[model samples]
Target: MYRDGAYVSEHVRPTTHAQIQPNGVDLTLDAIFEPLEPGRITRNDTEIGKRQRVASAELDRKVPETYYLEPGGYVVRYDEVVEIPEGHVGFVYPRSSLMRNGCMLDTAVWDAGYEGRGEGLLEVHHDIELERGARIAQLVFAEADHEGTYEGTYQGENYETPRD
Candidate 1:
């Protein structure tokens, strides 16, 4: 049976051109998270541009895709949110097909109650420069019996279901 919210993506089924894959969800090259300066753009020759998160001030910095990921890089977008239940765990992996072709994404993990939006960070492997919004990899959500409390603070808040 289907857990969490039923598969309600633009296209229904396990996998699609832009849908999350069963084994792994595909990552589309689209809008990426912002990583800029706080107030005045910090000046530094070596430090081109990077993202920094501050909890005390609840501030973030975003920049454009100037620096690539090692051999290569990418800015990925998702069609759906990868949600999970409290005390459960999830994993974000690159689609095997994409790996074989070219480009890859960093392995992401979603804990219980991981909610925000279907978005993620991608690390391209090999080399295949493509336009933004291209399908990159796939995300895999598994059912794990991880008993933990979703409290306190972090990135945002772990996505919650069965109550939303």
Candidate 2:
């Protein structure tokens, strides 16, 4: 079963009225980053390679903000810090508003017991203007049974954000 808005608000921290939806909570964009080089992952290897680091630009939330992307991909950090409840997994879905604007947010399954600020890949198919702190994606939780909690490489990662 999927969690409702009230349950999510009670469990998730740093939530706002505008961020809570009927079924999911909205996540805001804090900063945007571009990859300095190509990235790869090996299926057999459990240990992931070191990520290519590139400086990210902070999104200004005060005014009507816009960031231009030139038909490429970028990584966006969500401002919310989420803590998945026991026996539940989280999923991030791109807001329809973003898709209507010729962009897509690609996200990974947020495993049960994963806790931290999360990131998603924003693929811009055309030049688009994105508002700072805009609700670009929704984080939804669903019930799942797992043998153990997530304790992999990315566990408890990206928890602290200078922007917050």
Candidate 3:
């Protein structure tokens, strides 16, 4: 069963009344990063599990209020920090407004007991201007019957971007 807005709000940081939906919480774009080098992934090497190297340049929000994303891929950080509790998992979903603009967000599941200011891959099929702090995605939590909590490489990651 999915958690209601009240329950989800208790676990998310830097939230506003308007940002909380009936079933999920809306997430805003905090920063945008453009890949500076090629990224790689391999299934065989244990050392290469998540060590894929890729340099990136964070776009400056001072120069332009909105970042013009051409037809390409970019990484985005959410303004809010989330902490998924035990026995529950979290999922990020793209906002309909972003989909209407030919943009898609690819995200990973937030395993139980994971906490972070999450990042997601944004694919723009058409040129679009995204304002800083624009709501692009929604985070929803659901119940899960897991014997153990998440203790992966990305646990407690990206904690600095959330507002105070």
Give the per-residue lDDT digits (tens) of candidate 2, residues 1-164: 99997787765668999889999999998777777655566785554334443332245542645565678888888877888888998889999989998999999998888888888999999887776678899989899998898887777777765763
Q: List the residue pairs that clash in candidate 2.
A: none
lDDT, candidates in the order shown: 0.46, 0.80, 0.81
Native-to-model Cα distance after best TM-score fit, residue 75 in candidate 3, in Å = 1.1
Q: Which tens-of-lDDT digit does each residue in 1-164 have in candidate 1? A: 22332232322222454454434455454344444644343454233246542111112322322222334343344534445555456666666666775656675566676554444555555644443445555545556676664442333432331111
Sort by TM-score, best first: what order? 2, 3, 1
Model 3, 22-52: lDDT tens digits are 9999999877877765555567533312222
Which wins on lDDT, candidate 2 or candidate 3?
3
Residue 39 displacement in candidate 3 (angstroms):
2.6
The TM-score leader among the candidates is 2
Error of 2 at 163 (Å): 1.2
TM-score of each: 0.50, 0.85, 0.83
Model 3 backbone overlap count: 0
What is the Cα root-mean-square deviation between model 3 and the actual structure? 4.1
Candidate 3 runs further than 4 Å off: 43-64, 161-164
Highest lDDT, which number? 3
